[model samples]
Target: MHYDVFNGDADGIIALLQLRLAEPKSAQLVTGVKRDIQLLDSLNLNSQDSLTVLDISMSSNQQGLANALQAGADVFYVDHHKAGDIPSHANLNAHIDLDAETCTALIVDALLQRRFHLWAITAAYGDNLLSKADTLALQAGLSQQQAAQLQELGTLINYNGYGEDVEDLHFHPAELFQKLLAYDDPFAVIADKHSPYYILKEAYAVDMTLAQSLVASYQDSQLSVFILPDTSSSRRVSGVYGNWLANQAPNHAHLVLTLNSQQDYTVSLRAPLTNKQGAGELCSQFASGGGREAAGGINHLPKASLELLIQSVSDYYQVTASST
Candidate 1:
């Protein structure tokens, strides 16, 4: 058996998409909502199985990966997140780049020599590497209008991955990936008015409008905090809204807390774009949190601990901003 395990978000989905398109394959798809990163734990594999893991951090799933290797499964892993000390197992083929400006899709793009360059560009935009995506779009000779379309498409696909469960999404990420497989070109996905792009475009507008109307729960120069309801819309828009807040105030840290059923928050943290240095460290302080420097998240954070999370984020930027 072949397992295609990936994050459900735009970067993860597109990264695997590029590879599968370049070399068609039959694989068992294992994925979940954006927050479901510890995918390896759910796999039941054996010596004959081959696994491809994308866009998820190795450290977060290290134990499961180790077990798989010991069980004789061969693993190919590609990611841009914090990767602790990688294992030296011979069954592992790992490609990890921690550059804040890159995403897994772009990593695969380099491996494929840009056969799906446009999709990589879209993933960059979706990941909120705005300046990098723009530069790549221009270098590819894409018109401004064409670039915007890809950006929108990328953002929408990314948005669909947010919700708490596949039921909360417009299309399950697996189903969405299968739908996207028909169009090797991103433009074709756009040209078909009946595509997921059209549906997500409309849904995004509604959720974005609601998100914009929300007032910050806490705001000062060094940091801003937002607490959103546990609704499906909130889940869908949390990450994108955090990106928007960071862009609106590039020098300030932003925390977006979406209420979860456990009476805790699913936290999304973005370091000041101007000082993208401490988000991963700050988030890693939490049990279920991990990510890169620019953007990070926690699957669950207790309500009583909100103050501590805020203080940590604030102090981090306060010191960095002063030094710089």
Candidate 2:
């Protein structure tokens, strides 16, 4: 038996779509929201069983993964997240390339070129790699308008996975994947009578409005922070709101912090487009967070350090301003 495990966002779903299209075999899917990366531990794999992990980083679940591989299951892992030190195993085949601009979708696209090219474009768009998606869409013979629609669907699907829990999301990504499979092409799915695109758009609008209305100003000239209430909706929409805030204040770095039910806060940090190189490293210093040069986040930060962290961010910005 084969089980496919993936992040339940655009990248994971599209990667699975490509794999299924290429392999055309039935396999059990293990997936959850963006936060549910530690899903491999729940699976029961034996020496003969095969598992394919997509878009989830080994660094996040190294111990569990090491145990699984040692148990003799053949694991094929593809991801773009930061991997500290990968253990060698005969049954482990890892394709991990940490290029901020290249996502797992592109990695799968490169590996299985002709079999699933279009779906790769969708995944890239979902990851907000617009230029890359557009370039690939053009190469795939899709017109400008078609590419735009595909990008919208990709972004929408990606956006749906941002919330803290399943309830906060626009639609459960696994359910969304079933809807996506109904159409051979995602464009057709978006245009279909029963398409969930309309609902997604409406929900995005409402969330964006609430995000814009809730602003937390700071003293630094190039830094802004927004603290959201502890709610499912706030947690789910925090990252999107952070990006929106970044756009709204292009000169400043935007941090979106939201408290969860447990009173622990999740933080999304985005550096200005001008200096997006070290935001990931900065976040990692405080919490279990690392990402590409431009965007990253800390999974959890205690409420006690909340005010101190905000002050540190402001001080960091001040130092940057003076240094330049």
Candidate 3:
């Protein structure tokens, strides 16, 4: 069997979408909510199987990846996250770039020679590479209005991926991917009012409004923290809302913590856009946390550790700002 395993966020979905659109493939789709990155653990592979993995941290799934490679599966992996000591096996073909300004979709765009350039630009926007996406959009000859449309579509798609579970999401990631595959160009989705773009846009507005109303639980010069109540809306908007806060104050690191059923928090951390350097490292200090340089998350963080997390983020960014 051929399995197409990917992260459920916009970057992962769009990266895979571009490849499948260019080279039609029949494969089993494997994905989960944005935080569910250890997707490889669920699969039982064999010599006859082939896997395509995208936009997930390889170090988190290292054991599973090693098992797959040992089983003789031909694996194609692409990502823009922490990849610790990649394996040296012929069956593994890995493309990893940890650049703060680039994402997986852009890497795939280069590979495909911009066959689906517009979609790649949308993914960059969705992934919060704002300036990068804006430059690329300009280079592609897109009007400001057209770029805004793509940016909104990308942000809405990203918002839809933030839910804690598929049930909380407006549409499951796999379902969203299939629906979007019908359009070769992203503009087609925006133009078609009856598409997921419309549904997600409406839902995003509701969730974002709720998020914006809540005052920061803690705020200072170097960092600001917002703790969201335990609700589906909170789950759906946590990550995107964090991004919104980061964009609003590009120099202040923002943290969005959503209360989970276990009385713990699901943490979303965004480094200051001006200093997108230490988020992943700071988050990695927690047991259930890991991500890219600009953004990181902790699946479950104890309430007692909240202050520590905040202090760590503050000190890191403050020191970084001074040194720079």
- Which should have the higher TM-score, number 1 or number 2? 1
Candidate lDDT scores, in order, read 0.92, 0.77, 0.94
lDDT of 3: 0.94
Itemize residue pairs with steric clashes in candidate 2. Answer: 163-236, 164-236
Model 1 worst lDDT window (10 residues): 272-281
Question: Which ten residues in a row are the worst by lDDT in model 3?
Answer: 156-165
TM-score for each of the candidates: 0.98, 0.88, 0.99
Question: 118 in model 2: Cα distance from truth in Å?
Answer: 3.1
What candidate 1 gets wrong by more than 4 Å, as runs, is none
Q: After superposition, how far is residue 165 of candidate 3 from its true place, in Å?
A: 1.4
C-alpha positional error of residue 62 in candidate 1 after TM-score superposition, expressed in Å: 0.5
Q: Residue 52 in model 1: shift from native, Å?
A: 0.6
lDDT for each residue of candidate 1 in 252-301, tens digit (9 for 90 to 100): 99999999888789999998888888788789999899889899999889
- Our tally of clashes for model 3 stands at 0
Q: Where is model 2 more than 4 Å wrong at Cα?
A: 138-144, 247-251, 311-324
